[model samples]
Target chain A: MNMIEAAAVHVRFGDRVVLESVDLAVAEGEFHGVMGPNGAGKTTFFNVLTGRVKPNRGRVLLAGEDVTGLSPHRIAAKGIARSFQIMTLFDEFSALDNVMMGLPEFRARSHDVARAAAGDSRFAAKSSEALAAVGLADKGDIRAKDLSYGDRRALEIAVALAQAPRVLCLDEPTSGLGSDGVQRLAALIARLKGRLTIVAIEHDMEFLFSLADRISVIHWGQVVARGTPHELQQNEWVRRSNLGKFA
Target chain B: MAAPLLVLDDVRKVYTRGRVIRRPTFTLQANLSLDEPDIVGVVGPNGAGKTTLFEMMTGSNAPTSGRVLVAGTDIHGVKYRERDRLAIHYHQSYQVRRFRKRIPSAFLAPSPTRTPLVHLFDEPQFNLQDGYIGFMLDFFRKLRDEGRLVVLCMHPTAAWHLDILAEIAGRFLFVAGGGVTAVANFGALVADPRCRSYLGPEMTKAADAICHGAVHSST
Candidate 1:
């Protein structure tokens, strides 16, 4: 069964249709790649699938369960988590605190200064473990503001991973990182490949081509092409679109 | 593989602020290891500790914790003048040149010279004519050809040598607010989505173009 699927999903903002009856599906444990030009409804598609947007028509499903029109929080309860294109870390909090907030169980309680400050606590241990998984274990005590851009992104991913989602959707996951930052993030994502079902919207042709096991090109809010990287690389239509230059 | 020319192991620097209530600050923390002839390109947003890492590598600033070795020599324990035997620091004038970071007036206009195993170019492109940048790039490349490690520290906003570095450098060290992460080599670096994400779209696009052209030349 597909991990996540959007069947003929349609979304419109006022008179303009952002996603025009789009369809996308991520297989179980597959590194499904989504690529397209700017304003092509890539993020809007993600929003519809994650429950941030209620599609004008069609249904969304996760692991064979219908999730269409569910509020974001409700869908999240159904095990879907996503990272934003912008840096979503709390600048004032330490790396540990940021990941701790990602924990689904911990986010319910009131903010606790004492627990956040205590390094040896269970919450801190869980937070630190998540950070360690992303190669930021040593940066747990450092304020997120002090972290490098790469480390901040790593912390962001740590936050997402801590949620223990069955389906993780990444929107332009590697958008703001430098060469070094990109490699580190790719390494982390590569490690997460077989363990988690990820749908990444990436514009970096080189990174996306190598990272995604199956490629899907979205344009004008539609799934224009879907296949292996080799097939997409040779698609005449993809070669004529904005992706043509990069492919 | 060639013997590692630069090794920074769990390096950390702490600073004290607030005269009324001063506490140690963790200003820099980096763990990087690179081999000889590696043109290590370091770039990040302002306050990312790119310069300080150069300083630490050059023995100008002592790390609060961890070790910095050049050609297998621990630089912090060495004498001041003797320090240059392995590294030279070309300081940059940041927008806010904190009192301590003030590059002595005499050293402000100093030119880069090849005298050490590692050359630290801290904002070398600052206050220079366009022509000098090309010269500096060639200078950096020449030293790399001679098996020296050239660590170029660039400001995020400044017009960096994005194409040149992408075409030549083998490794990249990204420092954000003092913490550092290593990207193994140029090929692996370019294929990272974060390259476009963290470095911004324009620069990453330019680097991708440059890397594409370089593949032909390198082959």
Candidate 2:
């Protein structure tokens, strides 16, 4: 069954049409990639899916339930966790503390889970596991503020992963990292491939091609093409419209 | 070389929990200097004292030992008004609560207008949206364009703002449990195409180390 489905969705930002009759679906354990240019409304689509923004029309279903107008936190509680394209993190707190905040649901799951794991043991175990998965286990304790630009982007993914969501949505996960950082993040996502449903919006064609099982191209707020990576690489319209320069 | 924009000399912080006390000392013995714009990443474990280092540098909290100097001025020993003029510390959380309560009252009070030279941001990404994010980006951009230094205490996730941040400060330091491990020039890490993906593992490790170090060191 599809974890998330958006059908005939329309969204506007003060009359600027961001999405029009959009249809998208994320199946369980599927890694779907959303590709587009800067103003293509990739982030807006994510916002709509996660209930951060309300769509003017159409219905959004999460696990077969209508969740079009729910709040972001509520959607997150329903098993959708997102990492910002612009990178969002708690600066003053240590990286571990930031990761701990992502586990509010898990923290609420048990009382002893909070007090007994206040130190770096349980939190470290889970946070470090997520960090190590992303190749950031070594820097877990460093203040989020102290990381390099690239490292910060990776840390955001780690924070999202710590939430242990059923559906993980990432916006521009590799916007500001080096080659090594990109490879590591790709590998990290690859590791999570079969375990979680992922919807990634990216401008980096190479990264998307490497990680995405299915690629959907959005242009001017519409899905111009949807196919396997091979199919996308061979699509003439996709090449002309979005992949022309990159391909 | 010119003196560092900020310097920490024999900085020490000791926290006591009940009857237990733990004190960690950090030293920057070598002359650390920033002659031009650069982006530096400080990488270490949690307890390595990154926040404490920032507190000492921004003059929010005093070091048990040593001194923090900004622009060659001793911040801890300086008068309150003088310190306010030199730097402003931005907490991780906007403390919307405090802003709602204190800022307006302070503004209405007979306090002198404060324009901080260094804008310290703890978690700059916390509760940030399009408008506020744009405001912060523009604010720092103006400072950077005008050649001012802004120190950011940010998480790895929010590091995407580093490009704009570097445009302003041009230099960065990565502080972890072990102290400043990596210092890079401006656009050094961001300019690379692959740096974005590689960040995941590096940040995870650095954060892990700091948290582990902090907990153990504190205990």
Candidate 3:
């Protein structure tokens, strides 16, 4: 069964139509990539998938159940976790603490973050495992603000991983990273590819072309083109452009 | 019989300066009927009211006079939220414009069709670097094949851009000097004096080459 599906999702912000009948289906363990020019509503589509924005029409199905219009927290609770384009991390807390906060077990015990941070052993172990998955196991004790940029990006993923999510939605994961950082991030994502389902909206075509099982080219608030990297590169213009280097 | 796909009946839009004096700054007029499903390319210079024409066709901007009919339904009379169901206007990446909702949607009728009969793409970015042109061109053809009229408006800055319009569009509309002229084919479009002036020297030469079979498109 498809793990996550957006069925004809339509979102309009007042007079401007942002997403016009967008349909996307990600099979289990599929690493789907979304690419588009700016202002083409890529982020808005992500918002719809993660329940940040409610669709004016159509439905979002998670494993065949209608979950459209669910609250963000509710959607996250149902095993769909996301990392934002803008990093959201606790600056003063240790990387371990940041990941622990996202743990459902830790949150279930208490809303008192300070008390929960000191009272957990199993949660801490799970947090450490999550950090290790993102290659930040040794950086667990370091303050989030003290970590390097690349480490911070991995730490954000670690935070989502701690939730044991079925699907991970990443928005512009390689935006601020340098070439080396991107390479390391790619290696990390490669390790997790088959184990987790991922839908990433990325501008770096080389990264997506190398990693994604399939790519959807979004334009005019719709999926204009979609195919594997090889299929998309078959165009005459694509063979001549810099994107051809990936081919 | 089913109604014509799209009809612009004596449409006119005038933008006036000075609310008190109301002196007209610009005026655009178009009266055309496209009765079949096909790709129609629209080309013109900047500020030639092409965007205005598209907005009016999609029912976002109400024509100063006359009507825009999509499958015989008056698009402007349809509810604002439902207008896209009859005719959707896909704006250029940078060209985001909003028009006032003068009448409340409560008073307007719902869209007559579930899917749009007319699809207008305004200056879709055809970047060579992205190489999505082939897919996009195929999509336009797919829409036409499904029996929907496709209106593609583009400013052909490069020769390849003109090649795309020639290879894809069956007919052409040249918007200039506050009027719309329908050119029967790529051959006629390059030969028209106004279109030649709009295309300028370099592009006109390239277009002529395409018309004369000297330039072969790689598509």
DockQ of each: 0.01, 0.01, 0.59
lDDT of 2 by residue, A44-100 (tens): 899999888999888999889998989988888888889997778988766776777
- For candidate 1, what is the DockQ-based docking class? incorrect
Question: Candidate 2 chain B: minimum summed lDDT over ten consecutive residues — where?
Answer: B96-105
lDDT of candidate 3 over B135-170, digit per residue (tens):
788889888998999999989888889889999999
Q: After superposition, how far is residue A130 of candidate 2 from its true place, in Å?
A: 1.7
Model 1 residue runs over 4 Å out of place are A113-120, A236-247, B1-219
Q: Compute fnat per model.
A: 0.00, 0.00, 0.62
Candidate number of the best TM-score: 3
For model 3, give the interface RMSD. 2.4
Write the residue-wise lDDT of candidate 1 on B1-219 in tens digits.
554788998998878887998786757888878876868877676666776777788776777789998877787766544465577665532432322333333433221222468876666542222122333455577678878888877644422355556655668877675678788875566567655576787766656666676431210
Model 3 lDDT per residue over A56-140, tens place: 9889988888889999989999989999999999999999999999997788788999888887788999999999999998999
Off by over 4 Å in 2: A106-121, A237-247, B1-219
> lDDT per prediction?
0.73, 0.63, 0.90
Please compute and give the TM-score of the first chain of candidate 3 against the native first chain: 0.98
Can you rank all candidates by TM-score, best first? Answer: 3, 1, 2
Restricting to chain A, the TM-score for each candidate equals 0.92, 0.88, 0.98
